[model samples]
Target chain A: MARINSAAQLEKVRKDIVLKKDPNKPCIAICGGIGCLGGREDLIRAFEKEIKKQKLEGKVDVRVTGCHGFCAQGPNIVIYPEEICYTKVKPEDAQQIISETVVGKTIVDRLVYIDPNTGEKAVHQSEIPFYKKQVRNILGMNPKIDPKSIDDYLAIGGYSSLAKALLEMKPQEVLEEVKKANLRGRGGGGFPAGLKWETARNAPAELKYVICNGHEGEPGAYMDRAIFQGNPHLIIEGLIIGGYAIGAKQGFIYTRHDMPRLRENIDIALEAAREHGFIGNDILGSGFDFDIEVHLDVGIFVSGEASALMRSIEGKAPEPRPKYTRTAVKGIWERPSNLNNVETWANVPQIIGKGADWYLGIGSEGSKGTKMISLSGNIVNSGVVEVPFGTSLKEIVYDIGGGIPNGKKLKAIHFGAAMGGSLPAELIDTPLDFDVMSKLGAAIGAGGLFVMDEDTSMVEMNRFFLEFLADESCGKCVPCREGIRQMLRILTRMSMGKGKEGDIEALEELCEVGSLASLCALGKTTSSPIYSSLRYFRNEYEASIEDKGCTV
Target chain B: MSDILLTIDGKEVRAKEGMTVLNAAQSSGIFIPTLCHHEKLEPYGGCRICTVEVESRGRTNYVASCLYPVEKNLVVRTRSEKIDKIRKVLIELLLAHAPDSPQLLEMAKEYGAKSVRFGKEPSFCVLCGLCVRYCAEVKKKNAIAFVDQGPKREINFIPEIASKECWNCKECFPLCPTSYLQAAYVLTQGLVGFKNS
Candidate 1:
């Protein structure tokens, strides 16, 4: 396909791309995500080989897509058109799927998802309880598009939003839609994206920048990787539209250094987009010149912070600068730079294509649009689930997460790991809004929900966070570095049967110093592990002091 | 730059636009304590001992005066009961690493910080980055710099450069808050075996 020079040409190309494709055609989408890759059965090659063995070339399309978000059952495959969801798919099962399901049009009863609680099998992916409550507006496109193919993305009206933004809507109008929609940052902080874009737009700078924060350094968080790797074009499209809106001639995707496949997919998507004129000079004949470059991070957790991320992009050390003036106004070489998470970037096209009111129609009152959460740690389901805002924590833990395994009761649910707080099972009723969760001492931080079972000790959990954070911290501020070290020593002694009388008071003093006097957010909120744990489960710490036993 | 008026410690002070609150406070007589801050270097906000309570737009926030740019009508309190308590804890946290440093001892006395509270881990270096920043910024000799990260972080002299540069010019020696900088330089010189070239 040649470069689409105008909006009419883009529509024509989309029509041609959609004209040749058949929706009824059988497409085998294998979960090739980081979670399920080289899984229990290497099913990608197996399905390909089985398709060839049956000599169904054009009749069947075996596409390796991104994660389907049902990773508890390894090597998931979704047979399309019919949307027949198969869980725990094995290499040998490929032959039967090709022979029975693809050819004979029969349902494979054994591979279907069975609700463990109800003991009932479901044929379609949507019927599973794990997916029933989810509002998968962003990740739902993963199963349909092969990351390497631009046509797959275009078939779903992918760049049509960019077209609408470029052809018809003014930059101000696009900004207005986003501001009215109130789309919050998905990579934590939950600040409105439109406000940042508006700041970058209005700032008195001839040279401005927009960055996609794909350096998902949050532990157990892979939703950014899922949406970005599975569908890079969608995110690139979002970046292009953002650049057009923010009047930034240059854009960047600041992604992680690890995950070579994710990087490879992004490269392919960028090349395909540049070839198709969605990027590069005079995009789609709108005379709006903008291009994007991909930058790799230093692979530290704090490099994901906005200021630290900007400094890292400047080829400097990944130490966070004070953000008294927000990064939107002065960032990335001291220019107005608008940076949003990859997940937040992915939400832009939807808002631009379907108006702000349409986008705001979903989710809660405060937060608009959907959030993708990566479930991990003792949870039964333990996969990526995208649900709208205001979904209660109890619903997410039980319905979507499948609760804790081994018949053990839940002790607490932790969010944002070292920087985020933990809430006991009693407060799991709190909804997944930014203000609501943070008001309860828990945050919807980058949407990583880690569940702890009844046998787990909160005292030991605090020690674990401190131990990990004591090293991962940037070591710039006196309060954070020395404070975490002192707290870790106290928690270790308390866990190792050597608790002192004033250890709790010392920890509290350290927490006060950390919260009040640290330089960055990482320094300030580093005491969250102690804050929420002591708030909800102080008895565990008191018991550890009294019993003088290793809680672990 | 135009003069911007803001109240520091309940007194109206006129500060230049784009000037940090630390400099503005220093222009007046209001004292804000800082350890890693230096006039010749960029404000690092690392030690955070210069934290002051700034109330503006109905929000009270503790910000490092060394880096926070002075805003119009910013109500800055250089010292308060809460600020004293916070400074006491901060000094105590730093004193655990270098209890014998006279500079830290002076501040500890002022803030009522007890060195024995955290029980002395004793690395001696407070990681002020004074020698590092001074060497890099003022002397134009990148001899000593910060290495590693987190609690393992420390300032070390570049033996290759320090051996060539430091014997004639020991400008950073007086800037050390503790004896750790001298000790680290001696150790690095021993490792390099007295480069004469």
Candidate 2:
């Protein structure tokens, strides 16, 4: 493989890869994402052995690709150009899949996704209701490309944005395009990404840095993991573009150490990007030098905070300092640095490749583009969903998520994690725009949407979040460390039917102090769950206090 | 360096550029309560006792005065009803942890924090991170660090370096408000004795 030297050479290579590939050929794309790979490593081996035994090795193109988003059905396989999707596929079923679907073009009835409401069996991937509603700009390529192979990415027009940005547009123009797109930080803050870039670009520092925050420590969130494992080149491309936009030559990807598959895939993708001349020195002959170093977090949740992340990168204990000076001005060894979450960085290419107006035409007024939601808990179809920003919660929970399992009534939807709050079942029609959700006291934080059913206890849920926050807090400031500890004690006692008179008032006081006085977002937003729960479900707390038992 | 003029508690103060609110307040003879702040060491905003309401550019924010840089035309209220209430609550919370510490007790009295509302655990260490910061910043030993997170967060000696470096170096012992460091050292040394036995 020759290194791509210029934008014209990259375009030539893309054309060659596209022209050489046969679209009409029988290709098997097995869902090798983390969700599908659970207890299904044998499926890949079975397909390999059967293909070899049947003398269909080269004739049938078998590739293991990333997630397909509809993870309720595991070990999913999609046969293309026909787009036939098979779900709940087993190792033994690979033989029939190869002989019947690949060779004979016969549809497998048992493996197709059956719609619960219509009693209809969907044959193709696009026909499924979960994928039907989603406008997957970034995740749409997950089913097409093998993550380890850069050729597949190039064939699918992966780094075309980098080429367009480097060859055609100047750095200021690229930054202006992103600014015009009105892209906010998807890492839960919703701060304008354009302004952040401008600050880092204009700061009086000879050396600047860009970081990708992939350490998604939220309990139910796995969208970052899916994007990193499934489509690593997209992230790498976005990071390189961000490095160029911010005038930084060095970048870092800070991810959690637990996801080994994501780590492996990212490692491969970075090395491939470097070898292909997208990462290291004089990228695409544009004279912009940028490279990324992958740093695994130290397993603390607060380490994902921007300042604390920089501190961890500097080889110190990950504690957040007061942000009198924004991290964009002075970060990472006192140099201007730009750090964005994985999803936020992934959205950059589309804004640059396609016009900013094109990207802004999708979502609501304030927020632009689509958001990747990690739908989990009691939902019928629990996985990742990429939806437009203004999509209502009812549409997501009922339509895309397949509603509650076992015909249970939707009790509450916990948006975000401990830092974000929950909304009652009555507010299901709330649109998922950042301002709209935050107006209702719940945030679209990092896209963690956890659904609860009728049998769930609101007090218990609040206590569970408090316990999580208590465990994940960095214990830096007094209000966070002591305030969270005191609130947890009161909530634990109330959950156990030992409620004092002023427990509610005490919890409110703690929330006030924690929100006002705590240093970092972790401590500042830790009281969100408690405050919103107490607002909506005061009866639950009252029941535990007065009746000495939970009503639910 | 340029001089930044600010008003703290309705008194005009002239501060140099990059000077913190606490330094500016102290330079102009204004008193502010603090627990984890040390002039000889870098500012650790863990205790949050010196939080003040500062209005700049028409936005009011409660910031830790020790770390927040003084800006020109910034209006700082060192003592207000809301500020006093938050400070009192913080002192009460600290009293629950270090009930016997003379420094914490004095602060509680000064802030008029009459009662310990939460159940007292009577711990000696307040989790102020002063010792941890001092060891890492001033001494450059990094022998001690905060482990775990949230409520279970506690200061512990790094096992790899603790045994080799911390026995004779008692530099952070005096910085701790309570005798928790001496007690922890004795207990760890007792564990070492048990290992030998």
> If you score just chain A, what TM-score does every candidate get?
0.97, 0.98
DockQ comparisons of all candidates to the true complex: 0.83, 0.83
lDDT (Cα, tens digit) per residue for candidate 2, span B109-197: 87788556888864567887777888889889887877677778777776556666766886777888756654476438644754675
Q: Write the per-residue lDDT of candidate 2 for residues A227-268, one digit (tens) a residue.
A: 878999999999999888889999999998887888989999
Whole-model Cα lDDT per candidate?
Answer: 0.88, 0.87
Interface root mean square deviation per prediction = 0.8, 0.7
The TM-score obtained by model 2 is 0.96
Model 1 segments beyond 4 Å from truth?
A38-41, A546-552, B180-197
Runs in model 2 lying further than 4 Å from the true structure: A35-38, A546-548, B135-145, B156-174, B179-197
Docking band of candidate 1: high
lDDT of 1 by residue, A99-189 (tens): 9999899998999889999999989888999999999999999999899999989989989999999999999999999999999988888
TM-score of chain A of 2: 0.98
